[model samples]
Target chain A: MAVYTEVPDSALSAFLDAYDLGTLLSYKGIAEGVENTNFFLHTTAGNFILTLYEKRVNEADLPFFLNLMEHLARRGLACPQPVRNRQGEALGRLCGRPAVIVSFLDGVSVKVPGVDQCRALGQALAALHAAGRDFGMTRANSLSVSAWRPLFAQAEHQADSVSPGLAARTRADLDLLESAWPTGLPGGVIHADLFTDNVFFIGEDLSGLIDFYFACTDAFAYDLAICLNAWCFSPDGSFHRDRAAALIAGYEAVRPLEAAEVEALPILARGAALRFMLTRLVDWLNVPPGALVQPKDPREYDRRLTFHRQARDARDYGRA
Target chain B: MAVYTEVPDSALSAFLDAYDLGTLLSYKGIAEGVENTNFFLHTTAGNFILTLYEKRVNEADLPFFLNLMEHLARRGLACPQPVRNRQGEALGRLCGRPAVIVSFLDGVSVKVPGVDQCRALGQALAALHAAGRDFGMTRANSLSVSAWRPLFAQAEHQADSVSPGLAARTRADLDLLESAWPTGLPGGVIHADLFTDNVFFIGEDLSGLIDFYFACTDAFAYDLAICLNAWCFSPDGSFHRDRAAALIAGYEAVRPLEAAEVEALPILARGAALRFMLTRLVDWLNVPPGALVQPKDPREYDRRLTFHRQARDARDYGRA
Candidate 1:
């Protein structure tokens, strides 16, 4: 829910001239992506989304994100395909920021996803992983296991201020995750932050997946682990095992989990919880001045960490 | 830049069931209106704007605003006509707040409007006033000249904090406006808040006028006064007489201003400035917790007030 850059009318007209999107009819700054400025564009040709990459997005990675969308869509994945300009380039500059236009995907993201939606999400996540198997580009997961400890160090001093015992518990969890994090468990490209908000649904069917900025080469089971932390938890911090079972079963139906991947699920889930908890804690501690977005409560992930600690196997996640 | 209410998927589906808008393909919360939740809805039927009226708008005035849009569009003015549901109702409750869907208008609002654009705006504004003459509804301007004094009182204590000597200068201006404010100079339904953002244009052609929440029965000259303060001022607080002249002339080409209305322009402009200044000051002083929309600087209007103070007659506004 942000518009970090304001594109002027002249700049917009100039920017659109390079593309074959037809005459611009209307465009509005959409409260969509948090890390970039998005304008929902209406033109004579069709509707599209114009994204201006903010400072948080690496300019060098623009090709990776745009090309990956094209790659996924080419493989029958429902995602926004980047519209190239007359020069055959998907990436360009607008208002001195790297920008691209993508075909608008049709669906609404559910706030509290139902079990069916979770199942559909699981299927789509597996499909995405399968589609990216032969993609030409590769981006290492920046916020994966190795980054968690340093991220924790930045927020360590103030972690307990969020909750009475958050600091000590976080330190213990970090030590556990660092010591026991799994390797060689069917690694490939994963939508690392496949939260409910990133998956759009039309009724019970998943229509599209969006915000591929966090897409990276990582273990496929770790992606499922991230989803368990994101989608299987209720507002009361209770894990909905039915939804988890549906999600995991839905994933296995598409691409069956290997024995090692199944074995690594618990620790990966714990690591996923810690990864989010550390970031949220840091954001909670240092919210920028006049930021419109309220930093999510880090305690939510802290509770997930507690749940993952006691889970003994993939069966505890309702995985059949 | 506001979405105060979170409309759920089931609620949205049920809400759309009442309308013939076809299946909702996509909807994104738009950062458009300041006082309401706005979503740009794209459906099989077509694009439309879904507005959820926030607490700031009076529920009793819903009919007036919706009907006025209906009336204006019927008279061939380019504006968002309120779409009726199957029950023939234009307004319904969504997320426990009154909501209305209007036909989407195609055009971009200029951030820094050119002189030709100003001329188009003036013509459209006059057309709007003429079109609304026969609309069988009346609403008093909530933030008109009479409301400025009490609005000021709310922020008077902190007025100087916004600008040095602002409190003292505002009191003097209020006295002048109250004493010299003209009466019986051709009143009609006026778009009282016709700023640059509210008027959309494609190139130099006025495409649409929107955000009619501020529309009310008021002096037509006062509407022009608001425009003069809004569109005719440069970024550095300097007035552009050529742009002002073009605006008034373009307006007169459609609906000629009476001599008395012309004579009243100077004081009307001053009153317009005071009205916006007081409201902005109060909003600036008392911003609600976690407010997404930044309160516009009250000092912009204060600067306009200073310019209006020395303005002698309509001639000063480049009215030929």
Candidate 2:
């Protein structure tokens, strides 16, 4: 739950004046999207989402994220379309933070996604990758294989404090991921953090995808790997082969994977596991005295890393 | 900001099955109401607020609160109308907690409320008091004069930790309030917690009053006193006499204050101050480690107590 910045009523009223959206009927600070303060706005014209970029989001990367959402939406991907202000600017200042309003998508995110939802997610994700192929912008994936060691270094000493022998195991995983990380795969603008919560669904239909803060130019298969780690893992940290199979089959229905991409899946899955583990490890060890957000247990990804470490081929993940 | 309970998608979908409210288009955990989990539900039928009663609210008192809202709304008060399910029940279970859905009110709450807004709030509050008069059920104000001493006892040790000499000062105020607190001065059901955030205004018109968890049978003047402390104090802790005057005058236009009620205003205001101060002091000291909701500063009410400590008559509060 994220609402680090409290947008004052007067500030919000003044901010809405700059937009063509009609009289602000009601707005609420929505407890969603960890990286920013989000408000669900209902106005005379229509419902929309007002996002105030927080400290976690890089100000320099604002154009990349805002443009990516607009780009994805224009290309027929169901994503939020940024609403430019009267000055034709999508970005503006509100309460000393960069803020923008976007069209509100209508769907609820599944906590434990079903097999059908997994398929829907895979198809939507593939469509998102296809939609962003021609958008003339690029952001290097900051949490990819290259950043694992540095990220792990921050939590090295305290990692075992969370779980005994976690530090050594993480270091070993990081070493393996760095050495075996794939150099060439079908690369494009990818939703680097498409967790189940980020994708919305109305029943079995995928309504839209949101929270593009971590999106960057990276392997599309690596994005697929992130989904496998996120969606296909059971609460007990066991991998579900059926969910993974459905996800992969759904993706292939949109765009077939190359042999290299298919074979590289296990390593990429391992790398994705390592990436999330490192970040969560660092965050878990450094949660402030009274943070609203409880850090996601790094052990979840650690277990996923363990599974990927032993898997030899895509067939192990139920890829037909 | 409050979202203590996270209603999973399946649980939410199943919960909505009992209602005629069309297919759930979207729902987000709204960051509002400290004592309950609130979700802004937008459905094909219309927008509504789904509130799951948390620990802070007493389960047995649900009927009094829910019935009062329906009663008040029936008598031409602008407030959330509780939507009963097909079983003719307004209260139901969701996520293992007592929950209910109410029609959404459209307006934004003012932060630093303007004089006009204060006037509107005054009128609306009086109307709420009037509308709630005939409501058969009643709940005692749990944070009123009788609760202050026991509440203070809980926070006594750490009272000085917040501010030097606060403990002794709070004790003296408690002594004065216990002995001199007015009784039998135009009593009715009062919106005891009608703070600025609970009163919504679109421009200068008060659209609605919400958060009835603290609504109780108490002196109408005491509720006015709470409003005075809430709306008429500047950030500097100085009283805004003009705003207070506007508020009282606006309130009297709807329901005239009796001579006894007018005369009891200063002491009631002080009692109101002490009530909030003691509760806030207890909350401030006992906020659990890593709490999402920050306990409001007791010192704000402490300062108001200081102002009311010296105030001799209703004239000082701009109550003409």
Candidate 3:
């Protein structure tokens, strides 16, 4: 999260007083973000994360974040559980900002996640998506197919800076994505972000997942695409066919993709790539000096967006 | 430019009362961001973009953003010029947020930029870097080499969820990046976020460059890496070798890469890829639900990061 905002430690201690979690032993801000102020807290009770609602975070969405953690935790997802106060409220004021203290999960995010782990993550994600199917809360996919053009518009002038024929290629890709957008696919709650960092594990075992902030009602296959993008790549940016297979197989084992979803994979992947490319591009352009926030390299996403442009079929993902 | 945080049209007019931009004819919010609220404003004076500082934007950096634009514009970089008030202040409070009005650039962003355009963009970016050389600002690269490990640590638990070999590969890549990082590359002010969206063009001639928020003092070669990543790829995610050459040639025409910088290209690219991968992965895991923001696919970045893992020679980039 962005570190420009100051979230005082005293504020977190005050919230802990409500949770009946004993005295807070210590709290330290996790110095790793360009969006929100996050702190790792330890007390007599256990470990937890203290998140102050930073500027990018909306106050009204506090409950959704807190409650979703509770919901996912109840459903056997190994994730951070938002600890409620003695008054049974998960949301509260801290440092004059909305805040919450969530139970800190144990497990390391892997650097090089394995194929078995990929499969397990896939299975777990599918299960999580399934479990979230009936949750009363519903959020729309913000980076849906329709948002692509508007985003590309933001960076259109620099298209010449991107590559030979990139502008035309993107236009073609957009047309392809628009044409093939899924009309009817299995829709459900998806852990939209499922990047390697969000999921935690103990060695090869999938211990739990954290950071469900991006969870929303969307195409289930899109979640798989996010995972494929997150998990199935080699360090050199090449598509690792085996890893992709293992992940897809694992996902299909629990929640198989419908024929329509399969048909939409290419466009979905393209849309997904464009979504990230736009965000990264935006962030790249808008970084504030001295904010301790890093502007992401827009080119990486450019490459990925370009890749999605080439994917013509689900078969491109490799044998299922 | 998410919609919710946008300043109301009436409020925008009220804020403009402090300035002297004449009568407003039309104003519409541009909903294409996870941070900052942008409005396309047209008045008797002409078109302008009104930006309201959002949470992700730090208030303290207002002067830098505004002044940098003014600076670049004064240098004839075809960048947006910050319109100051009658009091000679480029920054002002608007709806409890920092706000500024920048002159609207005339030109269409290329949808299918050709290789020649890519070269032109490269040259323009180099010129921009040179122009900012004496701008008298010093902001360290926030996403510098030091940030990689901590970021990777955030996701190491799920290492097994990726390919078994990925962990070792990444570790090795990190080590390589560490050892190969160029220490003495020429430093200057860089328009770090020179994505196509932030640039403007009128036919074959470049018009203006926008989005100077990420402008900072950094290695000139690093800036080139950013450009390469932005310009050298096909829409289908394939590396266009010819485009890469053209872009490098264009850049070198203005500011040539040092032998050391050339040698460090692979690692720099790797570092660049890793920076986006980490940020995208983090954002992927943490996007708030029901928010107008879109969660980007981390896999796209994962692929790019992987490509950087493969050691490449400057010869691979071709002669300038």
The DockQ of each candidate is: 0.69, 0.76, 0.01
> Model 1's CAPRI class?
medium
Over A250-287, each residue of candidate 1 has an lDDT whose tens digit, in order, gives 89989999999999999999999888888888989999
Off by over 4 Å in 1: none
What TM-score results for chain B when candidate 1 is compared with the true chain B?
A: 0.98
- lDDT (0 to 1) per candidate: 0.89, 0.89, 0.70
Per-residue CA lDDT of candidate 2, range A1-320, in tens? 97889999889989989999988888899987777899999899899999999888899999999999998888898889999999999999999999999999998888998889888888888898899999999999988887888888888888888888988888788777778888889999999899988898877789999989999999999999999999999756799999999999999999999999998999999888888888988998888766878888888888887798889999999899
Compared with the true structure, what per-residue lDDT tens digits does model 1 show for residues B1-320? 86778777778988999999888878888976789999998888989999999999999999999999999999999999999999999999999899999999999888887789888888999999999999999999888778888998999999998999999999999888888889898988999999988988875678999999999999999999999989999656799999899899989999999989989999998898889888889999988878899889888988887788898989999988
Interface RMSD of 2: 1.1
lDDT of 1 at B284: 91
Sorted on DockQ, highest at the top, how do the candidates line up? Answer: 2, 1, 3
lDDT of 2 at A32: 77
lDDT-better candidate, 1 vs 3: 1
* CA RMSD of all predictions: 1.5, 1.4, 27.7
Off by over 4 Å in 2: none
Candidate 3: tens digits of C-alpha lDDT, residues A203-276: 46777887777777788998888887778765445677777788888988998888888888877776776676
How closely does chain A match the true chain A in each prediction, as TM-score? Answer: 0.98, 0.98, 0.92
Better of 1 and 2 by DockQ: 2
Q: After superposition, how far is residue A45 of candidate 1 from its true place, in Å?
A: 1.9
